[model samples]
Target: MRALIIIDVQKDFLANGFLVVPEGEKVIPVINNINHHFDVVVATKDWHPASHKSFACNHHEREVGEIVEVNDLPQILWPAHCVSNSDGAKFPEDLNTKVIEKVFEKGTKEDVDDYSGFFDNGKLNDTGLHDYLQSKGVKEVYVAGIALDFCVKYTALDAKALGYKTFMIEDASKGINFRPNDVQNAIIDMKVSGIRVIHSRELEKVFSGDY
Candidate 1:
């Protein structure tokens, strides 16, 4: 069975939100439409604490997008976003959440940042997403969501490494960094790890037989 893994499609990633991804809002319709064709739909949300170490607000010298070494891991300091119980953490109002079978809350710990839905940065713990999908007998996963160079890329890499046939729908993802060739770099990385990259409109052709 195949599943659609929607990562961090939250209000905070929208145009008006704290840490908006460029053109992030454009992916919603594509995600909503493809969700109907999948056997299972799972979503991930960034549920962080206000004082989470990943936030630039918590680090005096760092600014948003500044990279720092934390616990020997390269961490990007972001503006405080997706705080649990806050409006920014909520799913985008237009996202079709009713069809999502499982909603995974990640990055809640004050010390660790979980960019991938599969595991935390240090691989300290599982998000339980992989096991959950396996338990449901899911063999293939198609990933879509905000921040293509971060969450979306890491999730796809982890999924592909775990032996799932993973595909990343590029049109359904946006980059927060807006770095030169970041999207292209992510595509190259995904391909190197054996993950297929495609546009949302090509899903029908890529995953045939009713998806």
Candidate 2:
């Protein structure tokens, strides 16, 4: 079976939101159009507590884009965006949430940052996404969503590591690109790690059993 994993298409990542990823909202229609091509559709959200340590506001003398250590793991300080129960943490109104069979919430721990849907920053805690996919007999995963260089990239890498055939839909995602060429570098890294990078248009071939 195949699954489509949509990662962090929440309002917080939109252009008007707190942690805007360039052209992030552009992926929504693409994701919605591809929903029916997969056997299962799953979505992930960054549901952080108000005082989560990943936020730059919580750290004294630290600024956004600075690297700090959280639970001994290198963490990037970001503007507070996806606080739990906030509007920014919710999926955008345009996303087709009805097609999503499961919605996984991550980064809930105040002390840990979770950039991957499957695990926390340290990979010490899983969000149950792996077990869920295994239980559903999903052998391959197609990933798409906002911030391709961060949450989307980590999720796809983790999916590959867990023995699933992973593919990232390039046109169906966007990136923060905090630094120059960050998205380009992330695509190279993901491809090097065995994740096939494809465009959203190729999904039609996949659904037709022609790829």
Candidate 3:
């Protein structure tokens, strides 16, 4: 069976929000259109605490975009977005949440940051996503959402490592691109790790039994 994973399509990552991903809003329509094609659709959210260590504001000396070590994992200091129960943490109003079968919340721990839907950055704790997918008999996963270079990339890589056939819906995702070529490098890394990167249109053919 195939599953569709929507990674962090929250308000904080969209335009007019903190830590905005360039053209992030553009992926929503594509995601909505492709969601129904998969057998199961799951969504992941970065439900962090206000004092989460990943937030740059929590560290006095560090600034947003700065890197620091938290719980032995290299963490990027972001602008305190996606606090639990906050508007920023909620999925955008336009996202087709009705099609999502399960919603997995990650990064709830105040001490560690979870960039992957499957596990925390340290790999010490899982968000229960892998087990859930396995229980559902999901053999292939198609991922799409905001910030392709970060959460989406990590999730796809973890899925591949966990023995699932992973494919990244390139056009259905966007990235922050903090550094030059960050998005491109992420795509290369994912491909190198055996994740198939394809556009949403290509996936449409697969869903329609034309591929």
Q: Please tell me which predicted candidate would have the highest lDDT against the true structure.
A: 2
- Using all chains and alpha carbons, the TM-scores for the candidates as numbered come to 0.96, 0.97, 0.96
Q: Once superposed on the true structure, which residue ranges of model 2 sit more than 4 Å away at CA?
A: 207-211
Q: lDDT per residue, candidate 3, 1-211, as tens digits?
A: 9999999999999888887999999999999898878898999999988999999999988899899988788888899899999999989999889999899999999999898999998899999999999999999999899789999999999999999999999999998898999999999999999999998879867667675
Expressed as tens digits, the lDDT of each residue in 12-42 for candidate 1 is 9998999988899998998988898799999
Per-candidate Cα RMSD to the true structure, in Å, reads: 1.7, 1.1, 1.3
Residue pairs with backbone atoms closer than 3 Å in model 3 (clashes): none
Give a tens-digit lDDT track for model 2, residues 1-211: 9999999999999978999888898999999998898999999999999899999999998999999998899989999999999999999999999999998999999999999999998999999999999999999999899789999999999999989999999999999888899899999999999999999888778667687
| Segments in model 1 whose C-alpha atoms lie over 4 Å from true places | 209-211
**Relative to the unseen true structure, what is the Cα RMSD of model 2?**
1.1
